[model samples]
Target: MTRILVVGATGLVGREIVRKALRDDRITRLIAPTRRPLEPHPKLHNPLVDFDRLPEDAGWWAVNSVICVLGTTRAKAGSDQAFRKVDYDYPLAVARLAHRHGAMRFALNSSLGAAAAPRLLYSRTKGEIEAAITAVGFSSLTIVRPGLIGGDRNEFRAGEWIAARVLGALGPLLPRRFRISPAPKIADALVEAAIAGASGVHLIEADQLAAD
Candidate 1:
């Protein structure tokens, strides 16, 4: 029986991850900590929490695996530091707590251009969080780096919508790596990696995300 923790249960990719995990017979239990409440389920332990102060001693952190889909856009966050707090700080906090509580597997939904020294703050922050989580010592760490995530987001961005539409139209013509990655497919990969509990660090790049 695999017990799982999902940190960003309310976001685009996170929401899909939660729904899929619920229907997955391999997952015996699921813990989702978010600012808002989720729909009630028999297998779910949904806790309303402030990202700044997660409950370290909570029993829900003691799961077989963890999948973090937490992220925020700079425009929505309203500042660079605020964006880092959501994307980097929140996920790292969850990773450390889950690792301390004996969660052996960890999976992250990262961006395509994540790097330690990227010119873009967004990419750099994502890279930094990936490094931070790796330091937490999970037995199995899976990092799924996808291109611009294509989905129906609750929070609308005019620029993102236009880009997605263009990419959707040109998807077949573009190379696999350049094509947009669907949210549901990314969620499936994250869930499977967590449940599989494969040893060592594994990276699923933007191109691999297009494959089964």
Candidate 2:
């Protein structure tokens, strides 16, 4: 009966993770703190929260593991600062809080080309958050870097939609690493890593994501 926390549980991949976590026998408790309320579930403890004013001493922070699918696009965020707040600041804050509350395992849904130093703002933010979370001292850290995640998003992403079409047409012609990564597959990886609580640091790359 493992207790787990899932941030960004409202998004595409996050929603999938939440659904799977709730159904999973391994997880006994699922804490999802979101801007809006999530559908009630017996195993789930949904907390309405404001990211800018996260309650530092909340009891819900106590969990065995945490999976962060918290991320946003520059366009959607409207500004570079806003984008950074979501992609970098919020996840790291959750990691620190969860780690302080004794969460040993942490799983992050990151992008394919994340790097410490990158030309793109999106990749750079992802890399920075990855580094930030690593410093939080979680015993088990899993970073799942997925590429071109395929799913029916509530909001339309022109670039992702276009890319998905192109990649879908390319199909097996492209390398496994470059292929479309289904949202559920990525969700499964995050859930597995969180529940398994594997030791040390692990990076599940796009190619590996395509495998199972």
Candidate 3:
């Protein structure tokens, strides 16, 4: 049985992944360290933690695999530095801790434009995080890069809300690569890849993730 650690368990896609991971028979234990609490589950071990001050020596980091769905918008973060801290710093912190504790598989919910290139700050941040995570040396690295995510978010983002609606309406008429990706679809792909823990790096793009 595999023991897994999931970061960002409270978010939209993260919640879906957590639910599936908790129910997976292959997963013996699921550790989700969040600021708030997740509902009780027999297989889950929830630890309330501060991202800025994670417990360095916690025994819970000893997992076989890790799934990171941790991210934030620039608007919500209030600044570029704050966004980078959440998107880049936080994920890398979790990856290093998990790697140190013997986790071999690391799966991340990245964005479509993630690449080491001179692009938008958001895209560049994602690229840097991917690069940083690779440096951590996980045997099995999986990055699922979804486009505009379609789901019911707790809070509203004017731009994203409008995009999701437009792309959703376009549906099959829209190109697969640029279509609105359902949150659950991305979650499913991330969970499966993390649990599988296949060797080498696997980059799943939005078009592939959109597949049923």
TM-scores vs. true structure, each candidate:
0.97, 0.97, 0.97
Candidate 1 — which residues are off by over 4 angstroms? none
- Highest-scoring model, TM-score: 2
lDDT of 1: 0.90
Query: How would you encode candidate 3's per-residue C-alpha lDDT over 1-212 as one tens digit per residue?
Result: 89989999999998998888888899999999999999999899999999999999999999999999999999899999999999999999999999999999999999998974547889899998988998899999999899988888999899998887788788888779988778889988888888895899989999986633
lDDT of 1 by residue, 90-155 (tens): 999899888889999999998888893588999899899888999899999999999888888888
Residue runs of model 2 more than 4 Å from their true location after superposition:
none
How much lDDT does each candidate structure score? 0.90, 0.92, 0.90
Two-way lDDT contest, 2 vs 3, winner: 2
Q: What is the lDDT of residue 101 in candidate 3?
A: 91
TM-score of 2: 0.97
Q: Model 2 Cα displacement at 35 (Å)?
A: 0.7
Clashing pairs in 1: none
